[model samples]
Target: METNSKETLQADFDVFDISEEFGFLLEEPLTHLPDHYQVWLDLANNLIHLIESRKLRDLVDKMPVLSPDLLSDHRELRLAHLALGFISMGYVWQEGQHAPAEILPKALALPFWLVSRRLGLPPILTYADSVLANWKLKDPTGDMRIGNMDLIFSFPGGDTCRGFFIVSLLVEMAASPGIMGALEVMRAIKVSDLTGIKNGLIKVTQSLKKMKEKFKFMHNHVEPAAFHGKLRIFVSGWRDNPMLPRGVMYEGVSDEPILLSGGSAAQSSAIQCFDALLCIQHEEETGAFLTRMRDYMPPAHRQLIETLSVCPPLRDFILSCSNSDLCQAYNSCVSALVDLRNYHLNTVTKYVIIPGNHAQSVGCPFRGVGTALNTTGTGGSNLMVFLKSVRNTTQKALILERLS
Candidate 1:
């Protein structure tokens, strides 16, 4: 018997108020807030310049604290968050990782906190802000290829910074179809449609393969050396960091300092969406860390993951049905996801672990948001261990096909 109606499952997805066309991405993010918030727009637009001149702090310190209520729409509020996030990161680390600012000035902190709270995000740079909502179509009518896309704001690291953020955006873009496929699989499961389930899973595997191809382009644009020392620090958050033992004080928002995880690919909702729909189970520790990363995502995206988690168990269905075709389809989806994670693991080793190890060997060790590599992720997990656990758990989801 079918356990749920298609309409009921869809109602859950609709309640989150996400766009049908763009999935979790803020479609056509506002390039500028309204004129009253011009001060913020100005700061964000010229952020790289201000940081380069060591003038970002002076200007942010003197700027007026704006009310987030002034922003009228979802897109405006998101841009406000992204703008403030970029500015805050630049402000804190302006003097380099060794001398991060102990307090975020009220001009940036108060508004950032209010905006972040309203949006159900932490007041720091996150994958949602930097990658999902941080892009624009250069030609407006063109495809979202790297050459046709551009970043709305950035820190230092020049072309490398541009490459890193844009490629991450492209990865999200590549995952859109997989998101749709997951939705279709859920709908199919509600109706107990075997053909629908198998076809949907095939779509998912194909989408993941495309995502992997797009992810590999990171090497073409961002060099590992530049990413480790120069660009990585800007997106790092306050929690579990060695440098700021007490965390960051947001001048007017709270009397006590606040702790938050830095930006990480782990925060991206795309992969989590897959994990939930496929019913891939993780061990307790790995599962908890993933759940924590969800807090760093936009509220709607987080809710989507939660909703899918409680859906009818797809893995159990494949096992009980004893259908060879369905089992193979399900296994292929898991394998593609595993392949993507494997590539990501390799990329992290090259970009963070290898570079960080060499720096330590030369008598210099990194501190702050991340340490000498293996100890932490930008999201604060024990880097390689957490990733390996996740990949292995995903591999375990494959069911043995029973021959008819």
Candidate 2:
């Protein structure tokens, strides 16, 4: 979708939606930056190019900032330093070159940074601190207490978290070898192979379990009391069949029982139980559902409904083979879903289309929907644009009729 105007762009940037807009702005060389920053800009561009080209060996050797010493520095330097480290390590990994035993420390640090803090690293640390502090204040002896009160604790700590981190690290390590190789590596790493690795894994799993229990408690207790009488809707999809079970239709039912067997019925039964729907397969189903929903939903609900309908493609490839029948079917479904969603969106006077999961692909029209949502988690931005368009069109029509 085209930006409404530069005014809208500025307003969007005023909030944190600039990241969403960043995806759009990246389509063109940023004319907004001053000429003086060209060196830094060029450096950043070259860094990305080298990383992408798998030619990081020469680049990393020359860059002191990417050295293992910098990577092991305090938390503040970790993110920037680790990103550079990953580019170097990724390059080495791509070339089928394992780091020397001495250099493996640096290689391990790269994935540790990626798993612990790459995306939202600083914020996660801050949040973890806040959570631990709150827990300590409430229950000093609780199991939720942060063991390393001074050192930044990984949020969602425990064995499962560790396992996930390990798996992610291994996966990134084996990305060049592809998924099967990654899985093989995961299987090869026995619990006894590394000291404290089992304990770390256990902590991750326990922490995850605790997190789930806490969420379940909060959701059951807090959410019902807070959002009582409101219709809650949960929408998700199944892109990979292997990720799901065999013999299951793509666009049919959810595997989760709360959502699958009784979610819709529960919503229908109780004033408190919210309506939920999941589009498991083709994007087209989401579009069709939104179009059908428009006739029944109020203006307030229409925005979120529209947003869900217009979500971008949720998966990269249906399978490894691009030319496979599954890929074709998946693409066709996504295309149809997007078209239907847009058609329904055009029918509305004020609506929002928030994107989820697959927010990258510009080919999908709904990618812009993520931008339109801004950061408020509210439909105001979209509603404002839609309402303005409708009002302008109405005024134009009245003027034309008068002239006629």
Candidate 3:
């Protein structure tokens, strides 16, 4: 009966032609998805089982390195890599451990890194660190507690807190469309197909603009007090019996911690990819301002962004070709980007600065808000100014002036 039931559970996967395009992780109501997506559903569920059982490490090392090209073509493959990374952290970060998480071998880490970026997923480490690895207790006197002239509140964080894993699911759900769109954009760029590139960038620009609009929900719709209260309940049993994250994790003595430097900086990298690809250079302090923000991203992604930044911008490459039509397209793309960044600036004000004022975690290492600048210091505008600088420099970028 046991074997039969287990077989029946996964048997559903075999008949359904599972593929990544189905958006497995983001989909709700597992039973509602067509048979074509069931393969990944099983895989995703299995990964969940592994984490919940505290057995992720047993097979995490055995997971294979998949081609990003292949993963890009198939969302299931990407989903597998994502689940594996999440599972590893669930175990390695462990319950009750405060030290650094064990090193995720470059072999295991690299595939996830590539797959995630291509899929429009931000760095997994940042997702885990901000949402999972952090914790704060509710206390009138607790440092993290938000108290004002009238109200005080707290959130789930640290050990037993499922905030990281739980909230990350939502973030991924929110971000998956953008990630897929970026992958399409990169594909268009590779062929130097101007039309495809224009469409792709437009798609992403709109999506990003939408993302900024959604930031309003963080403030206007639910707000913090009721938001945190309800969320804690949703994640209530996470530590007791292990639920959304799969299970409780224990650290292994032999595992040494690997630190990922980022909390806010990773958010910037997504935007930086546009500049790097466009070869739009920032002048002096303006450029310096953005460079400094790179520290907030995971070291691997920071390295990736730095490498891309030094490459000749797209306009420089196109100018060498002397293709006017393509140049115009490039200019349009940059304008769209500027519009997108303008939206981002407003989001920073809403999500980061406002929350920071209310005692939420923001600023500095964690760029949700400007910590030092939260008090109106010099560096806070590092992010705000960078966005403005990009917009201001648009006409000066490669061929944008002629178009303007």
Instruction: Estimate candidate 3's RMSD in Å.
Output: 15.1
Give the TM-score (vs. native) of candidate 3. Answer: 0.42
Against the true structure, candidate 2 reaches a TM-score of 0.20
Q: What is the lDDT of residue 292 in candidate 1?
A: 91
Q: Estimate each model's TM-score.
A: 0.93, 0.20, 0.42
Candidate 2 on 1-404: residue-level lDDT in tens?
A: 23653454445333311122121111111212234323222333354345335555554444332222323323323333323323322332333212211122233333333433433231112111111111111243443222311111121122322222222222122211211211121222332222222222232223223322322222222222111111111010111111111221211122321111101100110000001111223224332432432322222223333332343322222222233433333333333323322333442212222322223234323211232122212111133343333233322221111110
List where candidate 1 sits over 4 angstroms from the true fold. 1-21, 363-374, 401-403
Best by TM-score: 1
Q: Indicate whether candidate 1 or candidate 3 has the larger TM-score.
A: 1
> Tens digits of per-residue lDDT for model 3 on 1-404?
67974464344223222112321132221122234433333433464355445455555555554444543243344344444444444434333122223355443556555655554443343332333222233443543211211101112222212332333333333333443444444555566766755665555556555544443333433343322322222212121121222322222211433222223322444566566666766878767656755654444445545655554445655666566666665666666667655765675565345644654342222212223233221123344555566677854674643431
Worst 10 residues of 3 by lDDT: 145-154
Error of 2 at 91 (Å): 2.4
